[model samples]
Target: MSKGHDFLITVKAPGKLYIAGEYAVVETGYPAILVALNQFVTVTVEESNDYGTINSQQYKENSLYWKREGNNMVFDNRDNPFHYILSAVHLAESYAQSLNKTMKCYHLNIDSDLDSPDGKKYGLGSSAAVTVATVKALCRFYDLPITNDILFKLSAIAHLDIQGNGSLGDIAASVYGGWIAYRSFDREWLKKARNTFTLNKLISIEWPQLNIELLTPPENLELLIGWTGSPASTSHLVDAVGLEKAEKRSSYQEFLDLSKNCLFKMIDGFHNHSIEIIQKEIRINRELLQHLGKISNVEIETPLLQKLCETAENANGAAKTSGAGGGDCGIVVINKKYATSSLIKEWKKNGICPLNLHVHQIND
Candidate 1:
């Protein structure tokens, strides 16, 4: 622990769902909307004597015993389930060292509620949440002077080093909380800058083309999320789409243009507090994703997901797949005047699990 503070520090980061702009958001400067849900990954860190242990409630069999050898973590076991957490530890410690802070061994305990009782993923961004929570917990443990922006940058670098692609929009939602309009930073510039700049200097500098704006939803708008009972791999879907990006030149560009326009309109609806315009744009964006799936020959919306959307639309709500969408959850935007009980019952009949999640906001 730092001096007199010999207590445990715990931090929680909420999981996220992509509301709009999934594939297009992967490109730099393109915008996307995401929400932080009540589901969270919590990390707790405590000072240890000499060696430390990394344990998780979800992965009890994969607990790790580690010790610091001059700021490097040397684990006793080779099999590690905490890849993103370890990355976050290294990045945050590196930043601390850049400020001439000493490193110490600490026991880290992780707990999560982002999955089902049987351990099936619900398509929420658990990895990003875990990384963000770990980073935040370390910041508290080390008593580092960090803002949300600095925390986001460090977490993003840690995540990007592992995932290598995709927008860090999930990280933004985890960091800032609530509904956010986010644009990705330039990956090419970051790739080079990581090699040239020091950790502290890089985090302090502004990232190119990155933007995040918190938004307030219309008073009448109601958000509903339904799980398809099947988990989808976002990276696999992204990689599959990447193969077609080069082949379908004009079609891909057209998809990007239309998605950009639709998301902009939806963002405007949030600003103007118009539920009608927002729902209309949601329908349009869903169609755009359908076309993209066709061109890419990928199953963006599976049969079950299609049924989930159709049921919500029949209930006078606009719906679509929340993320990569081959499986996982779908989101609905409806007017609060309408009751979702019957609609949710119908969803249950079709094997769709309606998640009782609310928007999570950071009160800072």
Candidate 2:
């Protein structure tokens, strides 16, 4: 990277949607596929004269003043409305300091389109996107050389510190962008590394079993998304499933094995460019999630999500609930032979809002 200059630097990180392997992906080395959406969280950094300030358009109350105190950020507000951003800044600066880079006061601003105009989250991994954006923007502001791998590790650690639990495939999508086949590394390993290694050393080392691969969709396949107008808390749903994991260990292991098989088939479908195989695996993955929900006593698919999937099935498309679904969005995989016009119309009539979103690539 070139030397830092007194100029505004902005970075945009895209949000993500899970394609398959939701709950199972939480386990280390378990695979999942996720796509980065067109929606984004943007962060800009510029030099500041006085006390450093953090401003956010999506969260007005989160705007706060802070100052550096011996390499640590001292904030004026204690509520911490923007924990992810704050955590990202701290980690990025800490990494930069380890390299003997100078840290200066800068004003950070965030704007997001990952939510509705009314500030409703679209369940598109806004928190992860924001964390990635913040880290990327600060890296640029500090003139730090960073690759996508280093960025992913840095942003993942920052996000995980706040969230406490998640598969963090969304962080991979945000950092890498586009259609990515992801499997999370061991969080326990990360926790141990944090205590044993420095931020720079931690980022430099390879994370065990963390894999991310960009994928290309088959030429005949297309994707469609429908929002149920009800936002679901992924953390809560994951926690609920975690509670049942111990009692229903056998069932949970079955879910993991089945989900792994289903996702591998879908990935092979991608590699071979077989739309038929992909669609079939999509349906099978849906059934797996349903079985998981039943055994865990968690509603992975809500009534509206069920309606959405059935409507798509009637239109000759394969559909399933996306993410830790209680109520959120469902994804449909359709062949080019099937026109989505009638399916979208049916969704509208049933009160499900069809999202005009596409896969987001890093080059775009």
Candidate 3:
């Protein structure tokens, strides 16, 4: 964390998935199990003389530059694909300024291995990963503390400002980077505390009692992830479900309770590599997704997703839509005894792309 030196700072944060508990986690502070993946979004910061610039392949523009306006770095162009990066920079600079520190102008380069070869997002928490990486890299470039507690909180607050409402399990997974079980922070509480972010208040205010735990996958646990050739807007789906939760209170609560149970079981199954427990829980979880979809009148499991799940079931393995579903990646896990070559081939024949993914570890 030495300052007054010219150096390039790069930080990579891994993408993540909610193995279970999606809708329920948004209810203030509910538990969800999220696993960080090998795919990552990385941010690199280097010193510049006049103004700051950011470059990324994800954006159609591909290059973004900003100049400081008084005490802020305002982008030359406001609407772009790289708002996550800009938001991170704004929050970090604001946070640092609050502590009587200032940042240097730098060229920020953002890149990711989180996309398929064809450049489709697989619903792997790309926004969350990018935000975490950007904030962490900026913190390092400016010689700020690189602790998980600091990084996670900064990234979560910045991202929440954009999305308005999210469980933010993705932020935890990217910061911690592993198979983590997370409970949402009290959104209501954060709303009350947003405008009072002095260092003393940030220190004294207890963070939402988040329950995040690392778990080891069963030694024999084998997982296969595949994309349905379509991406889902998690925020959009969450909003739809939120509306339904308000409209149909009793049924939504029932869905929430069932999802909570399934998440706990999946965590236990992963701990012991119990195929029976894992497989059973995944089926129940899928049913819960379908039920929610029905009640919310949203397509949780797309036709392609349903086909993939059905194929996995016929192969005697467990498969379900991961993340926000609708149209994104589906995960299948089974005991090593089952052969998956044919199943994978079936998935491809049906237009699903298999992803070479694994659980990622925390970056040291």
Candidate 4:
């Protein structure tokens, strides 16, 4: 890809589900399996004559400017919510300068479908998706090749730079656009780079100890998502878990080991397409999550979610809350014959809206 005249670029990135490994992944650095949803956060970019501006109808703003110091951005006066978008622009511009090319200032617009008709977010990793989409839009605007590894690096850094949490499993799934088994980046190494390296060096450096593997789940595997009609703050849940881990190290470590074992078995089951293996391992994973919630005093599974999971299990499927899990959604997995009539009825009776979400397949 090569830069030329000014052009408008629109990039869409899929939101992600934390299918397995949430809090444990942050502290223990174990692999987290995530699935990209069909829903997306969209970002549009093109050349602008004035100082850079970022807009978002969904975010209810316009003309969020990108002001900068020598290399870093001046985020003090501008709005805080668009920090991810601003970070992406700075990173891309810095890299372009590193290549001895000047980056033209651009206008950026952001949008997402992870929200409800009434404007409630469903905890679908919209921040991560937007970060990835921002990078994609900027790269395409500047005609940069968005290789998988490079995309991961830019998106992960942008997300982490603003949010200050997340294992970047969501970033990986959003960038890769499919199901993936991802391990967290080595933060010590990345932290060093963050402190000293220029944005140019950050983009060119070879990423060490980062692992991302594409996964192909069985064709007969089925997933059902039920929205709990409640919005959750993932940051709050993550912080609570972090504090609990620090206070109760041994207990947190025990839960981490158990969940890691469950995730490995689940991955193996996916590879072999063994229904029994997947079912048993998923059930074990659910129980361990419950144990974690109790020890940490975080409501990993709300009552509605528990009802949803229990109902699915009664219908011979395994289920659990998909993410940080205060009340966003729960996921159920089963065979192709997952026409669980009783489970569906129970979910409806409990006020959970069955969402029309499914696993996204990456395009070749």
Candidate 1 ranges with C-alpha deviation above 4 Å: 1-6
In lDDT terms, which candidate is top? 1
Q: Candidate 4's residue-wise lDDT over 162-224, tens digit each? A: 888878888888888777887787777788987888766676687665678888888878878
The top-ranked prediction according to TM-score is 1
- Return the TM-score for each candidate structure: 0.98, 0.97, 0.93, 0.92
* Candidate 1 accuracy as TM-score: 0.98
For every candidate, C-alpha RMSD to the true structure in Å: 1.2, 1.6, 2.1, 2.5
| Candidate 1: Cα lDDT at 299 | 97
Tens-digit lDDT string for candidate 3 (1-364): 4333256887899999777777788875566777899999988888887888899866646687788777777777766777777789887887777766765778988888888766887899998999999988887777766578778888988899888888889999999987788888887778777766774356335687666788777777787888898999999999998888889999988888888888888888878768788789888988998999999999999999999999998998888899889999898878888899999999999999988898899868
Q: Kindly report which residue pairs in candidate 3 clash with one another.
A: none
Q: Give per-residue CA lDDT, model 2, range 173-286, as digits (tens).
A: 999988999999999999998999988889889999999999999998899999999999999999999999999999899889999999999999999999899889999999
lDDT of 1 at 358: 97
Indicate whether candidate 2 or candidate 3 has the larger lDDT: 2
lDDT of 3 at 219: 73
Q: Poorest 10 consecutive residues of model 1 by lDDT?
A: 1-10
- What lDDT is obtained when candidate 3 is compared to the true structure? 0.83
Candidate closer to the true structure by TM-score (higher is better), 1 or 4: 1
Model 1 lDDT, residue 68, Cα = 81
lDDT of 4 at 214: 86
Model 2 TM? 0.97
Residue 160, model 1, lDDT: 94
**Comparing candidate 3 with candidate 4, which one achieves the higher TM-score?**
3
